[model samples]
Target: MGNKEQTFQKIIEIAYVMFAENGFEKTSLAMIATEVGISKPAIYYYFQSKDQLIAYIFDELYKEIQQDIAVDYKELTSANFKEKLLELGYKSIEAQGKDPYFNKIFNQYVLLAARDESYKSQLVELETSFLTSFVEVLQWGVRLGVLDDTPHIEAKAQMLALVYDNIGNFMLTGNQLNYRAIWKEAVHSVIQGGKDDK
Candidate 1:
C-alpha cells in the first residue's frame, strides 16, 4: 500500500481500539489523532468528522459480520432442524471468539444508536438485513416440518438472534451464566403448534 493508504488504515485501527474501549460518547477525534501520530487536521483530511469516522468503522464491521454469516450458511448440515440451528449458533459464537473487538464495537454502535438518529436508522437497517437470512432458514425449517412454528417463524428467528447474542456475550466474557442451555430448551419446546400442530 502507498504511504497515504497505510496511514489511513493505521488511523482506522487506532480509532477502532479507542472507540471500542471508550465508546461513542467518550472517544474523541483528538485522542485518535494523537494516538495515530497525526495532527487533528490530518484525521479530518480522511474523515469529515468523528461521527463520519465512527459510521465508517461501524459499516465496515457490520458488512464483515454479514459476510461471515453468509459464508457460514454453506457449512450448515442436513442434521435435524434444531440441531442444525444449534450448530449454526455454535458456529456463529465461535466466530466471535476469534475477534473480541467486533462484538464490543457492534454493541457500542447499538448503544450509540439510541441517541443518534442516523446511527439508529443504520443499526435498524443492519439488523433487518441480517435477520432476513435467519428468517429464511427458519421458514425453510417450518416448511420441512422439522421445526416448530408455535410463536411463528419471525418471532422464532428473533428469539434465535437474541439467544445467539447472549451466547456470544457469554463466550466473550467467560460469564458463568447459562443462557445457552436455557435458550436451547426454549427452542426445543416451541411446541410445534403452527402448521404442524404437534
Candidate 2:
C-alpha cells in the first residue's frame, strides 16, 4: 500500500524471523532494527517497544488464521465433513511448518494473554470467534452426512490445540513424530465416537 504500511510489514517480517531464531527472551529490539535495516528510532516510531511489537505480531497472525478459515469455509461448504476436517488439519500443520515465527508468537504471547486480566477478555473473544467458525464447519459436515452427529461440535478447537502443542513440543526439542497420522487418528476417533456404530 503506502510507505507507512510497507514499513510496518517490514517490521513484522523482521520480527518474525528474529522471534523464530532467537525466541522471546533472547530476541532484542536492536537485533530487529539491524535485520530490518532501519535505525533504532525508526523502529520505535512504528513500535514503541518490543512487547508491543510482539503483541501486534500475534494479533495479526491470530486474525489471519480466522480469515483463512472463513475463506475456506465459503469455498468448501459443499465438501464432506471428512474432507473439511482433513483440510483444516492439513492447513494447521502446514502453517506451523511454513510460518514458524507465527507459531512461536502464538504459543508464547497469544497464550499468555489469557493469563493477564487486561488481555484475557480480548483473548477469550478471539478464541470464541475462532471456535464458532470451526463449529459451523462441523455442523455443515453433519448436515452433509459425512460426519456423524455428535455432541460438543467444538472438537475442532481441541484438535487444533493438540496439533499446536505437538508442534511446539517438537520445535523446542527437535523431536519428530508422524503428526499427520496422529491427527488422522484423533479425527477418526472423534468422528467415530460421535457416530452410530451401525
Off by over 4 Å in 1: 71-84, 148-151, 171-198
The C-alpha TM-scores of every prediction are 0.75, 0.73
Candidate 1 structure quality by residue, lDDT tens digits, 28-136 = 8988999989998888999999989987898888788777556244444334566666556666665766767777777898888888898899878877877877777
RMSD of 2: 4.5
For residue 96, give model 1's deviation from the true position in Å: 2.2
Colliding residue pairs in candidate 1 = none
Residues 1-198, model 2: lDDT tens digits: 998898888888888877866677788888888888888888999999988987787677767866765735555543355655666666667766765565555556555665676566776777677667666766766776756676766675456545644655575455577767766766676566444221
Instruction: Report lDDT (Cα) of residue 175, candidate 2.
Output: 58
Q: In model 2, which runs have C-alpha deviations exceeding 4 angstroms? A: 1-6, 23-26, 71-79, 110-115, 152-172, 192-198
Looking at model 2, the pairs that clash are: none
Best by lDDT: 1
